[model samples]
Target: MTASRPAVEIFANPRADRSAPRPGVLTHEARAEAQAAIRAWPGYAPTPLLDLPGLARRLGVAAVRWKDEGGRFGLGSFKALGGAYAVQRLVREHGGDVTFAAATDGNHGRSVAWGAKQAGARAVIYLHAGVSPGREAALRALGAEIVRVAGNYDDSVRQCARAAAERGWQVVSDTAWEGYREVPTAVMAGYSLIAAEAVAQMGAERPTHVLVQGGVGGVAAAICAELREAWGADAPRFVVVEPALAACLLESARRGGRTEIPIAEETVMAGLSCGDPSPLAWEILDTGADDFAAVDDAWVPPAMRLLADGESGDPRVVAGESGVAGLALLLAARERSETWAALGLDAGSRVLLIGTEGATDPEIYREIVGRGADEVAGTVAR
Candidate 1:
């Protein structure tokens, strides 16, 4: 018999105050500025918003729309939007000879490196012990000088900040802390583009629920801000999902403030294995987000397979380990009637999910899905 999937941990944020003012970082002006600049870049294009009628039927929902970011800017992840856009802003403000630095599990580093290359600048990426070698190799291929840190993602963030400050290099981090908010603010603005495109692709058909994966909570908060801005009181109910092993966002929601958890073990969902929550992201998510959920690693592989298999005539999607967290949480939650009811999920509900990354690491993708990304995408014959 197969090992049973763990119970999903759900938290209805008690402090969610929708009447509060919008976070300053996510203003309309900032988002528009970032969008215009990013669009002007040579390879900018909107990723597809796929209709998943199969999953909708399985979950008894009216519809399920998936924003597939696997092929975003040919970088294989949605992260191509944020870090690269931030790098462009920095390069324009500063000079072309500057060095940009950041901490990453993989995708963000690649974006920063690619941006640096485009601007004729330098990139220095910091990685923790838990990050995969394939991710490191991908960054190196983009011309980033890799620095291995001792602890988890948060630790790597600290080291990256310190080294960048000491060496006079710019830190283009997605998370924000005291006295450090501008670059991260711009990063979040760039991320809002994903939500903007999704809303446009959706047209007049509005979704009732949005289930988004959270790492440091940057992307989740960005999407929430964007949708809420676009639709106001008519926006979808936002749900943030993270790995159970490193569910700092959930813990923060429970405590009614920013919180950090000790990462004793790393989840296979590498990008979501972040122990600390971003303060900038939390400001928006604290009020904008309706729910937070933690899903176990056991659900990841199956979610990836389900997308790859395209059950019930759904289109095949190349979702990576981290990319499937939102879907994994949905699958786990629907198994429990109480949890399902509490989330307000019903047959009439229209839900949206974000597939944040593709096969960022091909070896791991093959091991989990039993096929290459191209094969799952029908680009190669099986």
Candidate 2:
């Protein structure tokens, strides 16, 4: 099946000022602490930074590198780092039989549940009606008590907050509200580990641009902070990508603050279908991110299939619908010369894209990519 090129809306951040103090909540010291703590966990190792030469050639770029987080802690997403680290830190600071509660489209909740279990605490996860049954089952497998909300992702978040307050459960959320910022801050800090690994893996070869998929923007903020610290004034151009249907970050950038969009429909990129920009994440991305781009959901499946059918000796990648947003946006933008130039993309540009997950929902993944992750991996092995 041939997928049509996605339509994109690009907004350059007018508030992008990288002046005196950095715009991020996470400091280098806090990131270091989170990294050390996470490294102590069992099965903690750096995920791969794959060089996609064929893609680079096809896209008329110098290089296209993918930071694959599919196998991160075996959770199938990079989110495994954040919530788990925050839970560990929470347990260390405030002892006792605590319970963690939060809302998720899928991946973050699973990570939080796994973290709570590892920390000898309990977890309750709230999912919106759109969350797939497979995702709920995954959360249940991680020992989280599940509550299904009738509304969208934002509604689920509100429900989780109320339940946590009433039940005395600490919220280990990735998004931050007015008075509830600490845990989410810690979660963002933990995500800096990805940037650190990617930088080290690249060695002396720095990327010219980075396209990060955004939900509430925690991961993008974390990456921005790390890159800013490492490259100072010369950090690579950062673009936050989202599903057009649920582009809170893009809308927030256009509005010049933390803006919430009322969700009218669900996007195929379930994980990126967040209606609100995380206040904590927005603090950083407002200034640190150069541009915000939104893509049609139709682009996702084709992006996933492209990764699964690796080219020019590049190993197959098992990116989920949400995970392929960065690549989809890149492809969409490249089709328009003006958009490509606006993003500073050229033949010499070295681009970095994050493959945020494997087949987290195997059923949906197979439907999109035409094969299971394991099957693709087996082919790669041969």
**Clash number for every model?**
0, 0
The models' CA-based lDDT, in order, is 0.90, 0.88
Per-residue lDDT of 34-146 in model 1, one digit per residue for the tens?
98998888867888999999988987889999999988888889888999999999988998989999999999899999999999899999999999998899899989999
Q: Which stretches of candidate 1 lie over 4 Å from their true place?
A: 1-6, 380-382
- Write candidate 2's Cα lDDT for 133-241 as tens digits: 9899999998899999999999999999998899888998999998988899999998999999999999999999999989999999999999888888888989999
The per-residue C-alpha lDDT of model 1 at residue 15 equals 74
**Candidate 2 TM-score, C-alpha based:** 0.96
The lDDT of model 1 is 0.90
RMSD of each: 2.0, 2.3
